[model samples]
Target: MPELNGILVHPDCRHFRGDIPCRPNKENGYLCADCPVYAPVQERILLIKLGAIGDVIRTTPLLRRLRREYPAAKITWLTLTPAILPADAVDEILKLDLASTLHLQAREFDLLFNLDKDKEACALHDTIRAKQKFGYTLHPEYGVAWPGNDLANHKFLTGVFDQLSLQNQKPYPQEIFELCGYEFQGEEYVFDTHQDKGYSWNALPIGKPRVGLNTGCGDRWTTRLWSDEKWISLIEQLQQAGYAPVLLGGAAEDERNLRLNAATGATYLGHFPLEQFINLLYQMDVIVTQVTMAMHISIALQKPTVLMNNIFNAYEFDLYGRGQIVQPDRQCVCFYRGTCKLGTSCMEDLPADKVFRAVQASVNA
Candidate 1:
């Protein structure tokens, strides 16, 4: 306990901040001694999961279990995409940068979890001061990333070897929960929908079920892309089926979306910023997308989703009983390869009719 102006300060309180007056004091004008909302943090836990936005979103299920197991713990999460994390769930959401690294190195945590296998994340895990550490860390002797504990061996193995990844049936949430020594019970993703921002899309037609078509699979994985022709076909089919098909993507898919809109006359609202993009996705009754950020967002929003898969394992995703995973009829020769080795992508085998049926099923369900 620290003395502030001769009054004992509850530094262990989750809302206590040394730099400024805590929220309770500012809002209610109550001293720490008489605060009703005071919550003493029993443990300090650090979670390092810096990566692609989808991975960050999917990792949120662990927070549910962590809260259940350690209700009085103050959780700090370090990530590159801090904006995507639910603000209410995490006590501290620090963007992974030089300043964050320095802050983390200085602070001591009761428990630390480094979920990313990236060298930078592992290296930080190795140097960070923590009483106990779980998940992956940079090996002190070999200068390579390795599991910090035995429980992370399955996740570590699946990450490094494509063969093991293909054979593994454990979903991502289960794997991460096991790494932290907990059983996964179908925890839902914690997401910030940005509904507070008050974004609206008047251009979207009413009276029909809005079907969002997320067209891009990102440049890294060209093998995951469905052909423009396929998208056009799907859009036409959706419109004919009395569904209002909406084109969805960022700047990367703008041109394709424009082409689809011109060809099929589907609703093509131009791409907006990330926050607004999330809000736009929220309007959809059901979303049809590749295994990208939109897919994870749809899952988080609890929207009926139809996920298209080609390269990654279908079993890795836990849709929380709200969606279905549709894969190519032909087996993907490239398990995790960005470029297809088979001259043409196997996504061709997954017909537009199959995807339309999936969308129809998801909407009807």
Candidate 2:
């Protein structure tokens, strides 16, 4: 066999937890003896993250990797507001809300990871007791319990695990599969009623290859959109090519989604539940969106997606992959804050022809 090099350490050379003396350190430039994550095997785990439906969805893969590495461990997630709740690995969701008494009630966990930037998240993480505590390495003023708000100048999935171990961490991740052992089977996320509103997915139809369309982007970033005529022209082409387009958005998009659906006679499903919306997306042929979380969902599901962004640089692709970026590639306009400097003219420039070919090829592929 080839050289299988390793190291030996003193019994006193333990980590912060003084329990997990070491595992073969595969991160940074250091060995296990130098690592700070020295907790022994944990029985329960917790992960906290908030906002942006797409980001929450994309983070799902971390759970899968964790489960594969450690099966049979009980895992939980700490979530905020309306994020894509991971049903597969998480045994529970620690809701960060006004009515939640978890932190105040002195809930003890083996480990809890927070992955948000807001200061309130830091306070809660510090209070939650565990054998080992860790979070995204942030400023000292934030007052978290452990080491690492570790994500920094990283790309794509790197922003999750390795970045959390290196760069600037906002908080620790909330993935439940980090424990060493378990057997679980379920969908990526489960959509259910929100606080007894009597909502259900039973009424809506579940179709194959579900495709979601983020027709309305934030008003400030109008330069990132494809024009009305361009959208209509492209959807028409999709219909002609034997695919149906399902228009999606939030309550803020009612007027636009309604008008566009009327104008082109497309299927308009606006401002639905994020989980229900994701269920619909999982049933589509493709998702065509702006630089929104919906696009992230498509990436998480490994579904074909087309993102209409303003640029083709590595940064934009970091948020939205190049494979799903809109046609013609680069944007002539530079305005990206609240509204386009050149009005909606930048979006108007992209004709349906360019996107149509890409759509057909992806659909066929």
Candidate 3:
């Protein structure tokens, strides 16, 4: 039994390899007592958030509360998309690989929070050693992820039709804080840079309010997508109003960006690396996009955003009052489906003029 960073490095220590903390600075006599690399962990905490990308980013508000509650605790996070989590936010980031999964199951934690509702994450939560467990856990007989507390039930209910219809007014972060015995204090997302690219922007036109159009919503929920013609019309409106319309998207939207750029003469700043893209996003005066990761990013950056939402409930998002959610006049019959069964999609009913007005309002606000 050796001490690493003031915490006993037992066999259950996730940082321990054999009898010592893994990668300990040998200059500190290998006891990890004086090691600068590893801090003397006062508490062991684990957070599990796997991806749909946007959800992982949105969950970042919890980090501020966690750090506030356990100031000196050693925080370790498990995520599929580690890039989204800030480097300074957690002591260690473990990707959902075989080794990390096995290590987590073997380790003991002072506090553990598994917010994911996935079966695999919930199953692992049941096995991990922890003094206190918050968020979702595995159900014994059904083998599905179940809420650990009453507050968490609110979040669970929103997933199904019946519970969601109840129209819970609580914001996501507020409900998430209830599971951990805390209150949300308007904490923002901690999107730390992966690397400072120091990239310069000469493409953007000068002396005009930059309006970014995040074109792609990824492949998951096709119902969230707006028509290209609608986007073109919006671009034209922005240009007529003397606002610079910039097209933003990932590699998946390359062809689309080119087409939109050619059609509307908007600046198409093609897909950039994540960090560079973030830097670019910072330059925007207002970002107009579908309910995608870009919307979360815009909100995280504190930029005024106009989010075009159709399928997902608008109430679920907590934008900190920095953004506006524009919904179609007609109710969306397709909730979470990939395709719109109706001949006229709900998103089409959302005219370009309506979205342009939202952009104008967001920019002015």
Candidate 4:
């Protein structure tokens, strides 16, 4: 037989692209360094973030920094929701589908960053075709593991235990940046959407310092929701205090919004799709809500925000000095558990008066 050609030996290898020879790998398997042909690939970057709308939005700040660092690199982002990303920021957008997954596995990339911690995401990071892998990954037996970097390890350690997380002083974005060896310089959120749909405000008189109360905390985190009575009390108090209280929520919150509106005579702005809801959010002078998508939107719009957070790590939020974080007077016993073990939720213990005061400060500022 003719001499075995290393270049064509593993043509189907995930890293086998064009004339580029794979790196020498005797121990791990593919001995690319001994390949006959060698071709260097252009810088290709991959980012996988997946779902949870709020998280997808908060991660946009990384795009700016990444572009700055890799100006000529072709950036490809994989996300479940693509509507929220800036139109001109990314070079390619890949949805979380079979075709996209196959394409990613087959393609060669210089760097890959998987920000999500889900098993699926971690597995993808561990198996993808990239010279370097950053962010979280799955160990075959021990569950999710970081890239063995000090900063990333610290971030991962904090996530595993509540005690460590409570001591975290860096903001969420900064933590991610540091994981990639980049220093955070106060980057803000970027939310560029296709504003094809329009929402009519019904000519409601424009009120200065318009205050919006976001009543829903999403289905997964019921521990963040304030009591119905607390909401009603805050709405009534805001109105009496001379502020326009607009009730905001999705279909899940319709009944609650209706009840609150009827009881307090507050303006109930019916929920629209994500894009339309964001449009309405821009009209508000300030937003009051349990840490949710609404709070993220308010921060994206640079609107003053009064954020109520209890179970989640407070350090995760970076409101850019435009908001105040309100918590229950008592230390949360159910921190990050999503469910409250106590008979009454810590959120319920958060008095309406306290929320009202926070709202007032935000509205006036």
Candidate 5:
């Protein structure tokens, strides 16, 4: 890491304007570390974290921590196109569209944090050229080494993140407590961006302690998913039991979402903007999702959540939090495959009544 005026500027860092030549002199354009701007960067921070909805939800706590870490900075988030719709945590949401954004000039940002490990995402961080960059080192051992689909991969990532916090002198649980500085607001957050795939503003939360649900299935991947029929059955039970259901997912998941909505007479705000989805989730009492991101979002929301995971491959830390987990009665038979040899008999083993009881217990509790 090369230092300029106390700022660590890795020579690999890309910050200068292509044709506009400016000397790398510390006096004129000093580095991030030594500059007066670093501490104030939380106010003008840029974050690029894109993946499943749960991942985005999980990252919200980082924003809270960052704000507490740097109280005076503005936070501008770079969000995936439609995902940018309703993010209440972000001060401003920038679309990742290269065509439109390429014409826009880069501005001076105090820090850039890339939560996702996508190369394209890394490139975006390189472009912003924030005074500071925080992310997985892109190291081979940066996370768990996975030869096959396994829950340990998620566990490994959690461990890697913990180690990263320690390496940075930032502890884990305390960091979480510090970031979750604000008390949980009962209001549901909503979307601001209106791109096609983006969520609509009309999508709002209903009921106090509102709960969000991601009841979708997985086919291409080995990650577990509860059957739609099971989730629908649970939803109907909740409806008769006086609970309003809120379904969230991308537009592609809307068909499944509609199926759930039609069956239960609950609210089906089709895949709104990503921001909107999260904002709406904030108002939920809890979120119950398949093994994917449901529980992840709940953790971020500081609300209780329940996720159904394949017992063998669940992320340990996530399962430890305000989220409760239910798993297959048996070890994963199919593991990671195009299809399960047992026709996913292992997952089918979780009777809906047991899940319904769990839901009732959660809702009442």
Candidate 6:
């Protein structure tokens, strides 16, 4: 503890920041000695989950369980996409960078969970000072990522071998929870919906249930991409069935989305920044998307979703009872392959009619 004007400062207070004035002191001009909201930090917990934005977003459920388990703990999360994380759930959100890495190395934690298998992430986990560690760490001798404990072995094994991953039935949230020695009970994702930002989509059609069609699966996973014909068919069917079909994607799908909009007369509001994109997604009643970031966002929004799958294991996703998984009628042999092994993708076998039926069921539900 330090003293300012002969008044002892509570350094371990949750709101105390050594570098600058704390929020209470800045806003209300309250000194630490007489601050009414001085809550002591019981434990320091660090969570390291680095990018592939969707993964970062999905990992938010752990915060809920952590808050319940360590009510007075100061939780710090290190992630590449810090903007997506719910601010209210975390005490500190640090972007994964050189400065953050240095800061973390100098800090000690009561509990540390490194949920990423990346070499840097594991290396940090190995070097960091923590009383209890979970998830993965670097193998000091082998210089490779390894499970921190027995609980993480399942997730580690699944990641290394596609066959093991396909056989595993545990959803991602459950695996992460188990890694940290906790049982997951359908905890919802903690997301910043950006509702307070006052973003609106006035052009979005009204009256009918808005069904968002997320058209892109990113450049890496081309196997997850359904044919443009299927998308057009689904859009036409939705329009015929008296539903508003909205096309959603980022820059990659801009040209294709425009083509689709021109051909089918579906509404394409064009891509937006992350927060505004989330707000746009917030308007959808039901969303039809591949296992991309949009799928995670839709699930976080608690909107009914029809997830189209081909490459990844369906068991890996927990839709939180808000959606259903519609895989191709023909089993995809590619497993997690980025490109289709067969000249024709199994996604071709997944009929537009099947997807439409799933969307219809979701909307009606």
- lDDT measured at residue 167 in model 3 versus the true structure, 0 to 100: 72
Query: What RMSD value applies to candidate 1?
Result: 1.2
lDDT for model 5: 0.55
Task: Tell me the TM-score of model 4.
Answer: 0.83
Q: Alpha carbon lDDT of residue 39, candidate 4?
A: 29
Count of backbone collisions within predicted model 4: 4
Give each model a TM-score.
0.97, 0.64, 0.88, 0.83, 0.56, 0.98
Measured over all alpha carbons after superposition, the RMSD of each candidate to the real structure, in angstroms, is 1.2, 13.3, 3.6, 9.2, 10.6, 1.0
Evaluated at residue 205, the lDDT of candidate 6 is 98
Candidate 5 on 186-296: residue-level lDDT in tens? 223232322344444454544544457776644555445667777777777766766667787766578888888877777776665445566666667767776554455
Taking the candidates one at a time, how many backbone clashes does each contain? 0, 39, 1, 4, 22, 0
Question: Which residue ranges in model 3 land beyond 4 Å of their true spot?
Answer: 1-39, 162-166, 193-195
Local accuracy of candidate 2 as per-residue lDDT tens digits, 143-250: 532234322223223433532334333221222222212222321433322334444445333443334567777665555666667778877776676666778877
The order by descending TM-score is 6, 1, 3, 4, 2, 5
Kindly list the per-residue Cα lDDT of model 6 for residues 172-240, writing each as its tens digit.
Answer: 999999998999999999988788898768899999989999999898878888888999999999999
| Pairwise TM-score winner, candidates 3 and 4 | 3
Candidate 1 vs 3: which has more lDDT = 1
Q: Better model by TM-score, 1 or 3? A: 1
Clashes of 6: 0
lDDT of 3 by residue, 1-365 (tens): 56656665444333445644365533345543444445455789999888677788888898898888777787899999987778777778889989998989888999988888998889878889999888888889888879877767767766545446447677767777777778778888877543366688987888999999999888988888788999999999999999999999999989999999999899987899877888888889999988888888888888898999987767777778776899998998877767888966799889899989988888777
**Prediction 1 global C-alpha lDDT:** 0.92
Q: Where does candidate 1 clash, by residue pair? A: none
Locate the minimum summed-lDDT window of 10 residues in model 5.
144-153
What lDDT is reached at residue 39 by model 6?
91
Best candidate according to TM-score: 6
